[model samples]
Target: MLKKIGFVGLGTVGKHMAENLAKSDYALTVWDEDAEAAAALGKLGVKVGSSAKETAKGQDLVIVIVPESEQIVFGAEGVLEGIDPGTIFVDMGTHCPETIERMSKEAVKRRAMFLEAPVWGSKEHAANGLLTILAGGDEALLGRCREPFSYFGLNIIHIGKVGDATRMKMIVNMLQAELLVSLSEGLVMGNKMGFTPDKILEVLDSGGVASPLFHSKGRSIARGDFSRNLALKYVHSQLERVLEAAQKFGLELPAAETARKLYAQADADGRGEEDFSAIIKLLRR
Candidate 1:
């Protein structure tokens, strides 16, 4: 029944998620560093707050979906500063588990509830309210927030307790990175072997290895359209986090390490802001 919502972060996907929330019956107050972004949300009948602390103050629920963990937990005028005791704070961003654990401890100290609920999907999915949400925290707390989540999430899965969502996101992203790389390699090799890009896509799509990602992104890659869906830079960051987590457990991921290098090359080539499918461009070069 927590209807008062304070949302921070208004980036590509976050903005759409916030918009879906604004459409709900819940009263929403939002803040972002980008004034233009905040203004856009304000036009949707969402009350715009001047800062993160101001946004969190007196709200029954605070949701953050930023790129970096520091911005939410330790940045100037962060959410931690103004959230009232007993308010629930949910982070639906992909970040380091350790950072989220630290934030969870700080939330407990403030007598506030915290949940890590990283999501999976592109900006298109977010815009259409089809994103899959992986939540990690007290199940009771998640139950309290389920209705609001239904506005934007097609699936709300309880992964475990705090930090588990982040770990799950890393695992998912690692596989995503590898899959994209494998697709890129296959396309490039087929092209070199005299098969047209369209032919390659047709073969892949008609086969068992086909997926929604391959269907959408493969067509785009074949057509040389690298417009941003999930940016290469963010994928590269996730790969780094995955490798870091693997190392902590004395594990080796040779495929992920190789794919990370390709993504790094794409970023260096000024394709960081482009779709992750642009890694195919690196292979072509």
Candidate 2:
């Protein structure tokens, strides 16, 4: 039944996912480097573990959704320390395929089952329990976890196995980075040509290129609200992963490379914590 669950990492979307889990019937335990983040979950009856290891200890399932893979595994006081054999581990973060493969190997070494289900959605979707889960691992394991997963995921898709979900997530976010940059340039260009941002959005919405992303982020940028939904730095990191993978496959992604540089420049200017739509500020400059 995968009844008992331990969750590590309480960043942006992770916090919301854990919150949904705590609200569910599963016995949930959570931990994070930030005491305050873990404390919030405690209010909802989630047991706050002292560390990642402490959380994973004795739990049937352990989910790690941190920004980096290594820190939660082989890092100091990491989750691997607490993981018992037969525990099913799921990582729902965007990371390089190489890193995901390494984590899978480490999980196998510990005699635990592994799944990489990097989540795809904004903070709003996570908050509303509508995040899409791109899962990659054993099909039987996914079926075992479906009940708990349904508590937070709107769509639970099995992409393939091991590093597969990570690869998909890279492409998803690479296109996201490109799309946002393109939208930003359009808004900036249209605004400079004396069209209101709203008008530009209205026109785009009336056309074939219109999408949900365009509507939501376009309005947010129009309102000048760059509040962090998905951190720009993370998107930038995903682009790096995409480029790294591309380099290995000998694929030249000109658009992704150019978009990564824009995100990099924005990150350097101290806008890393802002929403990805906030890259328009860099484009505006």
Candidate 3:
């Protein structure tokens, strides 16, 4: 039920979310470092702001979807600079928990409410308005923003404090990477056994062991289609964080580590911008 929403960062996920919000009744303004991105959103009836400071000025709510956490909090004229006190700020970027806490404290000091609502799912899900949102901060605040959040996400989960949503988002992304890489390896192994990947998928589809992921990415991976819906490099970064978290807990996560290496190998092969299914490219190579 926000009157005005200012958004920063309109990359793959941010752009579509902003588009959906623009189609709504809320007055929307957006700013991105890329001029082309700003112009693109402008076409959707969104007012393109000149700077991050200008974007946040006098807005009831502000959203930051930049990739790098630094850009969201402390980049040149970051969100903290121009957002008015008492305005609700929601960050949908995947940032470190400590960093999110620090930024949240600063926002609180300025009398603004900060919510970390990092999302799960890729660009395809964003475009489909089916992404799963992991929201953190006050429950009442999340309730107030539910309508705007639902404009672009189907599943909205309110986790814990200001940074818990980011941690949960990383966990989900880590699992997604592991599952995708495992699916890629399984397809490669099936191919080696003289089984066509399509045939394997047919058999797996009818069993309880199969998942939507296997049927979706499985076909693309088998066909070696490494397009850029979900970039392999971003998944690799999530895996790195997962591994570090696991080590901190003294837990053994061998499968996740192996999957991380495959994603890293795929990224190293210059398939960084390709879909997570591109891990199959590394396996087949």
Which digits, one per residue and each the tens of the lDDT, describe model 1 over residues 104-223?
998999999999899899989999999999999899999998999988999999999888889889989999989999888888899889998788888888889988887888888878
Compute each candidate's TM-score over C-alphas.
Answer: 0.96, 0.97, 0.95
- Report every candidate's CA lDDT: 0.90, 0.90, 0.84
- 2 against 3, candidate with superior lDDT: 2
In model 1, the worst 10-residue window by lDDT is 68-77
* Per-model tally of clashing residue pairs: 0, 0, 0
Model 3, poorest ten-residue lDDT window? 67-76
Per-residue lDDT of candidate 3, residues 94-206 (tens digit): 86677788878888887999988988777778888998889899999999989998889999988987778888877788778877877777888988999998999999899
Which runs in model 3 stand beyond 4 Å of their true positions? Answer: none
Task: State, as a TM-score between 0 and 1, how close model 2 is to the true structure.
Answer: 0.97
Candidate 2 C-alpha lDDT tens digits along 1-285 = 678999998999999999989888889999998999999889998799988888988989999999875666667689887899999999888777777888889889999999999999998998899999999999999998888888889999999978888888888999999999999999999988999999999999999999999999999999989999999998888898899889999999999999999999999999999998999999887
Candidate 2: global Cα-lDDT?
A: 0.90
